[model samples]
Target: MHDFDLHAPEGANKKKRIIGRGQGSGRGTTAGKGNKGQQSRSGGKTYLGFEGGQMPLYRRLAHRGFSNYPFKKTVQVVNLVEIEKRYENGETVEPGTLLVKGLVKGANPVKILGDGDLTKKLSFKLVAVSASAKEKIEKVGGTVVSNETVGND
Candidate 1:
């Protein structure tokens, strides 16, 4: 249609709800606050897990066990099976190459795991190779060169 004829669609512009004006206004008196309670009063609110005059469940339960998950390293993983399927013999495997090959993404450090049989003699660089993975690669006449310590997982 024409630019000058343009207008917002139906209900696109809504009137602001006017509340607490008077009894004539539907949302007046209690202003839709319902019956009297701790919530009906001004600035009356309860903190999370608060129990009225009683101990909260959070305080009742024993705070247990330390978890190392938050502190654990988040490494991008590539499997030996994937390497066997994707690369030719003697090609270098690294995070950048893995990204191009669509095996892994992002800037996280790549860790190679021994998940499948590898028949090709490929070389790995700048990536952590797991212990079992290193064994498989060596058995297949491949080599791994890493700046980081070899991972066990």
Candidate 2:
């Protein structure tokens, strides 16, 4: 077809329904919102879980059980392989050093995990060490100074 013959397909460009213009427009006055009460007035929509003058389901049911999420402790973990890559032979590995080295972040406690080999004789302070990781650190002449226990033995 020629460029001048181009035209939109039928029903593809229908005009939007004009509402609340005047009574002669058919959709005017009420604009399909129907007569009066909550929905008819401005900002009169009911909130979610709202029931018509009765107790809502969320309110009728008992709020049961306790949550330990509020008292839960969050710990940041680092592996031995990462320490061997970032730290020197005699340098200390702690939360602050780990943060500076981009191994861990935030103020949460740090826990070292024994995932790979460690050769440097480093010192660990103010951090927790897993049972397996502690053995690995001591074997490499590294020292772990914290008494805070991490995961289950």
Best by TM-score: 2
Predicted candidate 1, C-alpha RMSD: 7.6
lDDT of 1 by residue, 16-72 (tens): 999889999888899888989989999999888788979899889899999998898
lDDT of each: 0.89, 0.88
- Residue 77 Cα positional deviation in candidate 1, in Å, after optimal superposition: 1.6
Candidate 1: residue 105 Cα off by (Å): 1.4
The TM-score values for the models, in the order shown, are 0.59, 0.63
Q: Which number leads on lDDT? A: 1
Clashing residue pairs in candidate 2, if any? none
For candidate 2, give the lDDT of residue 77.
83
Q: Can you write out model 2's per-residue Cα lDDT over 1-153, one digit (the tens) per residue? A: 786998889989999999889999999888899998889888998889888979999999999999999999898888899998999999998888899999998998888988998999999998899888888889989888996746633
Q: lDDT for model 2, on a 0 to 1 scale?
A: 0.88
Q: RMSD to native for every prediction? A: 7.6, 6.5
Local error of candidate 2 at residue 62 (angstroms): 1.4
* lDDT measured at residue 94 in model 1 versus the true structure, 0 to 100: 87
Cα deviation at 96, candidate 1, in Å, is 0.4
Clashes of each: 0, 0
